[model samples]
Target: MTDAPAPKHYAPRWNSDPRPDPPAVGGERETLSAVLDWHRATFELKCAGLPPDRLSEKAVPPSALSLHGLARHLAGVERWWFRIQFADEDVPMLYYSDEDPDQDFDRLDGDVDEAFAVWRAECDRSRQITTAAASLDETGVRKRTGEPISLRRIMVDMIAEYARHNGHADLLRERIDGSIGV
Candidate 1:
């Protein structure tokens, strides 16, 4: 008698995303923006299909890095780097203060949906600022140090920021559930 074939196994999928793949070849601005946007989408994908408790679960012991916290922190970062620093907009800070600096990650207050909405708005504003700039060489002053920072540098730095946090997100997502992927 022929032996029974091994059963097929399929990985669980928690969410479906229509995020476009970044172009392998493109202009500097286009390439940077696309990659950044892709990272943003990846961040959201990691947090999708989870309840609020799961979203805010500090799955890893001794580290308070939840998907919810990441969402809040990233929203602040997008505002701080893009609007406040790069565009020099006179906007109020999102979730920060001198007395309570790590509020974004530490204090996971407010609606998750609201946090995401704010993040999206900040990203849209950042895109507008980037598009309006004459070149990546466009400069903005550093708040702490009286030095100029270029738009190109900001984009590269933001990409790195997202990359590091995305790594954290991967771990957080995996810990939250068996699901995993880019």
Candidate 2:
């Protein structure tokens, strides 16, 4: 008798349960936080439970856009906006060194856990900074560019940036396997 092929093992989808609708907030500050939360959650959902090879897969030639890279890039994004811009701290950028600025997405020689750990650390830092701020009206200066900006704008920009990257992640994940959705 011929042996049957084993069924493929698909990674479990991240947080498939739908979130309860956000409660009404008193003002724009609360609303902005809620939006940011949603974006963050969505991004996390895309990367959850992916294996190392899958996370670091270079499906597209000449492009280093892997799940690990995305996570690393997002960590850099948080460090730039929250740590440098908002906290007024002088922190060196991660994943981007002498080699290439695009190294954030470039596949490096590390286990999947390392990349995810870095990503989670940055995400937690971002949440702490955002949560501590009194309001979106808080003003801050960009460290590198020396441009005047406000927390409100940063919050909005973060959401937009994350949303765009999340779209890319969705397609990448789908290509890796067949799983989809939050």
Candidate 3:
């Protein structure tokens, strides 16, 4: 009996490129909000219509980077910057443990629905914390490091971080499937 050849693997494709024209903004919202919104939308676009396995699949063997892992990392980062840093609350970091400081990106055998739900919940919480700032100039000192940080700075940092990771996710997703942008 002849053995069939292995199925060819296809890369991912994105519909809307990140280099597209920026969204139009009017009064009230600052540049920070616009940046955050762009990153958030990009993240959602990268995650749309992906199955749990694809979302959670590791791009590299034994590497802690995956679409789901990126989502989880962002969730933890949002909590740290907004809740702990901005709100000055003593809350435990999500998915963090002594054994793994970077549990956010660690390989986990979790369902896709659970990951999506967690990501959505965290995104909502992040928006709430960001929107509550009295102004872009509002400052909050980090409890752990005592470094003074402004809401504007935090939001900008978040946007930058998310943008970078989303780029990685885009490439990874493409490698996983022929699916592309939103």
Candidate 4:
């Protein structure tokens, strides 16, 4: 008989969304990027096995936030900060416009699989950009202000943003079912 595919191993009930903790070794770039990657994986893990309908579900009511929306929102944020602001790449907004500023969350009109693809691409690009940077002190101008923003500041801000939003993801995932942790 042909070799059988390996069986999937699901996390035990006691395992609350565990992920690889941030690296204990490496320089600033390595450590910061590792932690960011961990947070990114945590978000994906929180969304693991969720159906599209549930991902799009605004189960909380009165709040437009959904995992699908958060994915799109984070994609836009990644492009905004890393590509537009730091890399100085000229591009249009991936989602949202003056007339539809909150479209990322307010309206779920497209294929969520596509949205996740876009988010994943953006996240990968952001990591690549961070990796290629000469140093954390390298500066880029703020989009709204001509004032400069250091790569270090951007990293810290992004970490904080993800941390806060992951908390939201936690509650959202739990509401969808009862998954928690990381």
Where model 1 places Cα greater than 4 Å from the true spot, the runs are: 1-15
TM-score for candidate 4, please give it: 0.88
lDDT tens digits, residue span 1-182, model 4: 87999779754432554666777887888888888888788778878888899999887878889999999898998898889899998988878898989988988889998999999999999998898999999888897988999988888888887888888898899899887655
Best by TM-score: 1
Q: Provide TM-scores for the models.
A: 0.89, 0.82, 0.79, 0.88
Positional deviation of 128 in candidate 1, in angstroms?
Answer: 1.3
Off by over 4 Å in 2: 1-15, 18-26
- lDDT string, candidate 3, 126-167, tens digits: 778777877877888977778899887888788788888888
Number of the candidate with higher lDDT, 1 or 4: 1
Q: Candidate 4, clashing residue pairs?
A: none
Q: Cα deviation in Å at residue 126, candidate 2?
A: 1.4
TM-score of 3: 0.79
Q: lDDT of all the models against the reference?
A: 0.87, 0.79, 0.75, 0.86
Task: Look at candidate 2 and tell me the lDDT of residue 25.
Answer: 62
Q: Which lDDT tens digits does candidate 1 get at residues 1-182?
A: 87999779764544566688899999999999999998888888888788888988899889989988888888888888888888899999988999999888898888878887888888888889998999999998888896989999999999998999998999988888877876
Candidate 3 global Cα RMSD: 10.7
Models, CA RMSD each: 6.4, 9.9, 10.7, 8.8
Per-residue lDDT tens digits of candidate 2, residues 21-110? 445765787787777777777777776777788888866566668888888888889888888888887889888876788887765677
